[model samples]
Target: MVINTGLANLNRYNLNFIIIFFYYAAIYGTIAVFEENMMIRSIKDIILLVISFITLFIIIFKKQQKDLFVLFVLFLFYIPIIIIPYMFLNLSEQSLLYGLKITILPIVMLFTGILLSNFIKKDKILNCFKGIFFIITATWLIQYFLGIEKLLNFGYEYGINVKHFYGYLRLPSTIGTPDGYAILLAFLSIIIERNIKNKKIKILFFIVSMVFILSSTIRSAIMYWLVAYITLFFLRVLTSRTKFIIYSSLLLIFVPIFLFIMSKVNNSLFSIHSLEDRLSHWNLIEFDPFSTKGIIGSGLGSVGASSVKLEEINRSLNGYAVDNQFLAIYYQIGILGIIIFLLIIFYILYVFFKKRSKGQLGIIIIIGTIVSCLFTNTLEIYPYNLYFWFYLGILIDEPELIETEY
Candidate 1:
């Protein structure tokens, strides 16, 4: 791909303006925190909704194609799938609201990406993203060295306590937690690598980002980075024999060795205990709509992090945080919601594969998202979801016949 740094000549898209919402969302991990301040939380939600509607209006105004229409239909169909049961199940008001936020946020983010794709040239978007990436990474680095997170008031307010792993402070930077920081930066790093023109510079950036990822001690981020790199490698190498050899090595040798190392680390990054906790959460098959709740779920916000907070206010709920996004859907939305959600993913992946050439970077980034979603609620949660959907919009919103110009 060609690196287009000649931003001066390109038509103005000012699409970079949208980054503020994502920046704020991811920087603070507000949805996970800020439970005490309803006013602040409400403001954040309103900002997201407004931005989404504005982007949706742009997509409609610009004359959307069948693909966009299909997305629209899916978005429409999905609401009732969650909402209908939410109402009928007589779930707590908090659950309903939380459900709506997660459901609507991604759709809005999708539209936002579509809008950006239609107006801004890809090169410009990449150019602007580099600026954002550098700023965020630098801020994170500064926060780490200074032993302070108060650079942003909200950052200090909602931030998780600084964690120490391997005798170094686990840097959450402005994002509140190490896992949260790593997840967002991991995705952004892919975009940065795609955008940066110099190979040495790109590798340096990768090293720096990996430092943060490792220091943070978020095992899922490490797993995501490894899986994405290996997948990217497989995609780049063409020979079947080479592919087979690599696969055999990874499966037969590398994975077992890696697992052994993880076992020894006391599950520092991804421990057996961590795996057990995740499995225990998934063991809530009894709560499955097919098994219990029927067509609708207990309610929207009833299952995950939001449920934990809502539970305080409404003690009647058996709200437990489900680490897995897919299972979270089943527990909160029910059988039909889970099925519809899965179908949506299948359809999106099908579309992604069909247009793989047009959005190779996007495809690779999404593969990471798919893997991360299984282990973490990053996609369903805020800030993380913000970047996930926004980047996703940029990736899949390709114009037909749009091939990489480079």
Candidate 2:
């Protein structure tokens, strides 16, 4: 089941496109450093639209007729779920388009990943990821130690202020936000752990990843990393009771130390107070599932990050800042939409479980992502969201493509 690692059988055109797309996605935040350049910022959106259209073309004209039909049926119902809500809510065209793009991006990237699995070598993709990991690690280290204000101010223009905890800046690196950067590190760490066989190098990479993620001070990402590693350990690396006992003993030893550190921080940022504020905010947002509008939704772009562009609507809806990804979907698309979203996620997990090849990493990442969505609108985040869906398609559809380089 090993996938060929050579480019001889690869589709050069598709490989080039995927390479461009991923590399661009990797550096997307750096592009935002040029705050004065509107066109440069817009390139992210333009490239996204191009990818979406290209995905549509692949769906329409590619040889996977059965998959095309399934996708067609899925979107046949899915598009109207988005559009009808927009029309009913009388939202602006800009909002509608923006919403549409954000909502469908996962699907687009999924197909793109499928195309990637077929057209490109897995080693090439892994190499891209490794390269991205080093570059980001270097930049993040520089940003954190040097206090690079420009990098720190990356997302301020978008109203996302730099975060701080205990006199330390929650470094965003080049990813524009600490949370997004943390998410990226979580995924990269998994890839590094699974692919890199050198024990010392793997441990070094893990340590650096932890430091960077910890520097970000994103509790969810930190938890995700913990869970992903534990899942990987239990499922793949170790199957013996002794191994479990050893892992449990380590957790027992570290849990108290970790709690002590949290207690000492005394900052509300990582404390239960922050979580209470989130829950209280969620309580303020009312959606009557029994109502007609609730059945469909308030509309796309009526909530979450994309709604920020719809100033009036966003204001009227109290900025529509449903931080939880699931709640955001429910706010925008209603009960049916939420149901569809859950079904998609569960279905993917189901497939991964049943197929259960070398995709334990994928399963772990997906599980971590699901947990992450509970705390933040993960799908709304750039690069993380793109990588999330892209890897979903690749690892799930072509699990064999994920091979250990060592």
Candidate 3:
């Protein structure tokens, strides 16, 4: 019986490893040749499906009742938001397919996170992530010194695809794009700050990480880091003096640096043009608050990546990409959809805040995520959403669960 139990545990570990391996692959594996390839996208979908299936099996086999319950609750809550909008909006088949791909793909991450916490130690997870960050950051630096395109076929769109404004090359590292790299490091910085023990080492890491993030030229990432700093202060992790010093130092050093970079990138750091464009996008939303479509929404795929494809299928769609998450839901899902979305986010906040005593890193990560979402629909995008749900699982799970033997 002991041997049988050991075998089962080994099987569990093996399955968990596969899920995480593929999860990261799906996030960080960038091949420009496959950018618009349907086959490559399908393969990624298949991976997510397999991970979800294995996660469900393990949850059932192990009688992880709490996990099962949470999964059920999320599915139940999201059903109307996804379904009603699709139906009410009459989204095209292509659009529906595209929308669901982004919307549903990351559910696997939640399960993966749950299973990962159960099977692995936090320290082990941290070490593994550190290795990944190092590899990616090194690649990013290589791209900066020697162009990524010259080094390999895999090149950042900004660093290679588009003409660099002036000589600036916004290196994306392995995270696929400039914005993605910044967002990724934003979340990573939280984890690093929380896990590192030595103050001087932590400070060094912060300086290095911030440099990488700023070099990405993603203004939202800059905002995310600032918000994270303030959030950490509110959590009492940083003393008032430390906060003031860090803020002052970063502002003095990086503000002009970002301004100069943005100027060279053809976008000013304080570019009113960009802000106006964003506002114009928001103004395009025309839902009738009293109408059913307005109340429930157009549906999941009605507004984003899938929506663009939908325009090809139905000319009336003329899909627009609203970088803002709040507006995206308001346009696609309607008022009820936004309500449901807020409720879900609030629940995540509640869980993290409740468990903040033990999950301070998780709390900060979620806070950063919410802040980022305001600007870029982090919950709707790939990898970013995956990270959000993944961390949510980590935050909500009982501490005792992670302590249990695999």
* 276 Cα displacement, candidate 2 (Å): 1.3
Q: How much lDDT does each candidate structure score? A: 0.65, 0.72, 0.64
What TM-score quantifies how close candidate 2 is to the native fold? 0.86
Across 1-406, the per-residue lDDT of candidate 2 in tens digits comes to 2434443244456666666777787777766655647677677778778877877786776566344355445655677788777666666677667777766665677777766666666787788788778877787787767664664454344225355665667766667677778888888878766777788887887777777776677778887787777676667536578878888788789988986886676454356766777888897555778887778888787778777645633434436667798888887888888887777777667767776646676788988888888888878877878878877777766676584532
Estimate candidate 2's alpha-carbon lDDT, on a 0 to 1 scale: 0.72
User: Which lDDT value does model 1 have at 133?
Assistant: 68
Candidate 1 Cα RMSD after full superposition onto the native fold (Å): 5.6
lDDT of model number 1: 0.65
Q: Which portions of model 2 show Cα errors greater than 4 Å?
A: 1-10, 65-72, 148-161, 236-270, 312-318, 403-406
What's the C-alpha lDDT at position 301 in model 2? 74
Worst 10 residues of 3 by lDDT: 397-406
Q: How many residue pairs clash in each candidate?
A: 2, 0, 4
Our model 3 lands, by Cα RMSD against the true structure, at 5.3
- Model 3: lDDT equals 0.64
